[model samples]
Target: MYDRLHHFYQHALALDNTPAPDKLTLHFPNDRPRKLVLDKSKLSQAEIALLNTLFHTNVAVHHQVTQENEWLYEWLINGHSPPKHKLERLTPPPLRCIHFSIKGELNEIDAFIEAIKNVFPSVTNLLWKSRTEGVLLQHLPEDTVEEELSVESIIDTLATDFLIQTSFFIGSPIDSSHLLYERFKWETTLYDAVKMTFRKKSFFYEQEIVTYYLLHHIPESTLKLVSTMLDSVMNDRELIHSIKTYLECNMNTSLAAKKMYVHRNTLQYRVDKFIEKTAIDIKQFANAAAVYLLILRLEAK
Candidate 1:
């Protein structure tokens, strides 16, 4: 079944200049058709026969496809009704279909319907139209104008549906290529979402915006810790200037003291006070690494 569906999609994509169909309309020739259509009323008996012939199993069948002359409707209706004359009028009578595989499960049907719904909200609409459109009728007259579905419209709708679903599941706005790349990793998916988002508004060089939002997801406690460290040494502007100079000089305290026009001993005194207030020993490179990174982030913003 998966292979069959894949082939159908591949064929659809292969169409070049040919106009795309409005809906998935399969035409079964008078020769060999791969599907069976069942009457809603005689479904039970048809299901039993199908199971016996195909699987030699006596399992109950809960699903069947109703054959309209031109289209097949997978039925979810209940017990049989009498065969109406209208059903016979269909060029090709509907055949009842049944499967008795032990692996057959309701979840498969649910998944299929869910996927189909995403691509075509008009599935039920088509079914409703089938009731009035009649089976095996001639194609609409070329001069008879009607609204037609286009490949572009269908593709756009599917793309929008995917973005909505992805955003809802990811719980974020998903506005950047980097975030999208990390999450979905599909180039096409990322391209479509980014294009759609850009269409609604202009996106400037977004590196700064991406960094800001990335930081927003960081833990509050971690941000608070960084904030507290910066605040502790904020009052001593001279000491702060000395420390910044020292870092700028690649941690050469003598060079920093010379640049600040201060004695080395006085610079050392301020460094000690900074350590005491922040409880961060700058002499140990590992402890100073996080502070340096935070400073870079702050400066970037």
Candidate 2:
């Protein structure tokens, strides 16, 4: 919808000179440098009134589209996909989306986005829905989703330079633009699930927590059992960190200790204490799965 209009407007602007007609340009309120060019002379009275309502009286134009689920407003502005109507009909190239939420001032958010664009020059689209939240959709070769794109170094620089907390949720690559809308929704779900638990972290890949994908829907009885299992270390931040690191390191005490900058003996003691208190040997597959889901549940609470 907007693309066709944009091209047409550009053509009209090229052919005409000044004092030709009233031109209305609607600038999107985001980091992306894009806007809609409306030739007022080409619009009917009704159309003009509608634009007024959309841009002025009723709501903020950028936010309006985000609130409407069916509208692919962000993608359209960032040139990730065409208008919603046409995008649904055409098959687009494989693209991946990384949804991000940055907590900071407007300037900090802008700096972070600029840094991202500088790092990933091939980034297909970087769309900001608001002052501090947006999605970055990029084109990548098929089956290379896991290999490409490391946001750790970029995030570390941004965190240190800008003094902000930033997090990202990377969704799987999809072949069609039509699937992006649903994929974006899934990214949002994953982001919300990890936000509280991983506040100090940089990013979370959807594949990393596949087992806890439905953590929010787990039955209360099961959740309670998990809560009970880890009740002793419920409020112990250090102990909880030890367990999380140990599990993430695949039950390797030496590696986990190295990552935590602690001695192996200290790490083993913490792991043993956790087992003694919970009586749930995290070394076991089933017990590990339960504890993993329990961690998500606890953080969500």
Candidate 3:
């Protein structure tokens, strides 16, 4: 339903954390983690009232997103390139975006900023996309010996201070300064979609971005069909767990057995049995990808 309604509107931001000022941010009581954004200019008060009555949701008419800094407002809200002057003026390259998503309200903006600086000493810049959305610009150090940043620590700090369970995604380093805005926006969209799946306060990186994209774009019908390819494995709880762990461990029998607390020979037997039952050459990347996605699809369901 969310996707159908989202497709109908040309400017829908299907669960975007940073709701553009040009779009109307609608919140449904049922869909708490998502905000269906649309161009409110295209909706009259009468139409808006009717929509409210029909969908049982509230529409927040954003009045020109001018609350943030001028450059940030333009870059994030208007989807404009970062000002050349600011790019030239600020610190050098190697800055990457850390897109954050928090569940509840943030009453202490000052404290939140302090916590960010504490967690990331090399943080060169920062900006809030919305109350629930923010971006931290970090200048990753050239040297590798510095203290490693623990995502759990940062998550705990924010949760204790702001009383909101937060999740963040560390984007790939911006190779080109010109692509900074575009790349950050893309990561923010991905973060918004993937954050809800993570139960604990933690972080993710660029490696999982493509997997999440497939999860978002693939239809349930196709996933259901894919599951049928390995229905026997899916039906048996042990084979399901064993195969998933084995594939996730890169099809290494001993490593998967160690991870799953099973003997190597036992895992190898299970693997052979699964291949004989399904006739799937799970060692191949393509076959592994389909099975991995099927497992993820069922887990998500």
Name the candidate that leads on lDDT.
3
Instruction: Rank candidates by TM-score, best first.
Output: 3, 2, 1
Where is the poorest 10-residue window by lDDT in model 2?
A: 13-22
- Any runs in candidate 3 off by more than 4 Å, and if so which? 1-70, 80-83, 145-163, 196-203, 235-238, 260-262
TM-score, candidate number 3: 0.69
The lDDT values for all models are: 0.38, 0.64, 0.70
Question: Across residues 1-301, which tens digit of lDDT does each residue of candidate 3 receive?
Answer: 6667777765534334443333445565676566576655465667556665676332221222334355665565545467578667655677788877678887776777778777877886666655666677788666655565688887887888889888888788876667776786677667766666534426787888658756766776887777778776677888888989999899899999999998999999998888889999888889887878777767766
Q: After TM-score superposition, what is the CA distance of residue 278 in candidate 2 from its true location, in Å?
A: 2.1
Which pairs of residues collide in model 2?
none
lDDT of 1 by residue, 142-225 (tens): 344535334345434434544321111111223332232123222222222332333322221122234333443456577666
Summing lDDT over every window of 10 consecutive residues in candidate 1, give the lowest-scoring window.
Answer: 93-102
Candidate 1: pairs in clash: 37-94, 37-95, 37-96, 38-95, 38-96, 41-80, 41-81
Residue 38 shift from truth in candidate 3, angstroms: 4.1
The C-alpha RMSD in Å for every predicted model, in order, reads 23.4, 12.3, 7.2
User: Higher-lDDT candidate among 2 and 3?
Assistant: 3
The sequence of per-residue lDDT tens digits that candidate 2 reaches over residues 157-231 is: 777888776777777878877677667755655665556454555677768744444665577787776577777
